[model samples]
Target: MAEVVGPRLYSCCHCRNHVALHDDVISKAFQGRHGRAFLFSHALNIMVGPKEDRQLMTGLHTVADVDCSDCRGVLGWKYERANEETQKYKEGKFILENLNIVKENW
Candidate 1:
């Protein structure tokens, strides 16, 4: 089990209601890995990233994005591919957009 750290401000993208931050972890990606990584939550909240940072697919945000309660800040993420958590995410639904905004990032 992990600590929720503390209550944070988050406007639910689903409900648009400010929610509390719980089980949020720092996320990022690793080099030379095959798949993406993410700082997952046991609460089943799908967190991606701002379109701006989405360009970077090798750093933490490259793998995933963890927003604050208000979508104002990135609180946590995973930056590697062999994160050991991919299997867990596979059971659910995770989508990575290949806009090819600039290519070479992914």
Candidate 2:
């Protein structure tokens, strides 16, 4: 018989709650409020806060903070809308800070 392996995941650093999958990572070259961050196509076990417009390095964007549902720790933000056409690709995507997430199932 063969053993089963689960998907690689990223979890909240403070609570170890599964947040995003490694396979969902879109880009590792992103900047967060604290430091380096990763762009993910999807995230789990997270709650999106109220949307607000903020000025980021890329441009003005409407974003919402993403929090860990279990611990309510701020993980990152989700891009709700992008003002720049060149940055439109970020809309509907999520950013998970490297400082706030840990690798799991690897």
**Best-performing candidate as measured by lDDT:** 2
For residues 1-106, could you state the per-residue lDDT of candidate 2 as single tens digits? Answer: 6554899899999999999999999999999999999999999999999999999998899999999999999999999999999999999999999999999877
Question: CA lDDT of each candidate?
Answer: 0.33, 0.97
For model 2, what is the C-alpha lDDT against the true structure? 0.97
For 5-100, candidate 1 gives per-residue lDDT tens digits of 535423344344332232332333422222443332332233545433233332223344444344443333333232244333422222321110
N/CA/C clash count, model 2: 0
- Candidate 2 at 32: error in angstroms? 0.3
Candidate 2 residue 25 Cα shift, in angstroms, is 0.4
Clashing pairs in 2: none
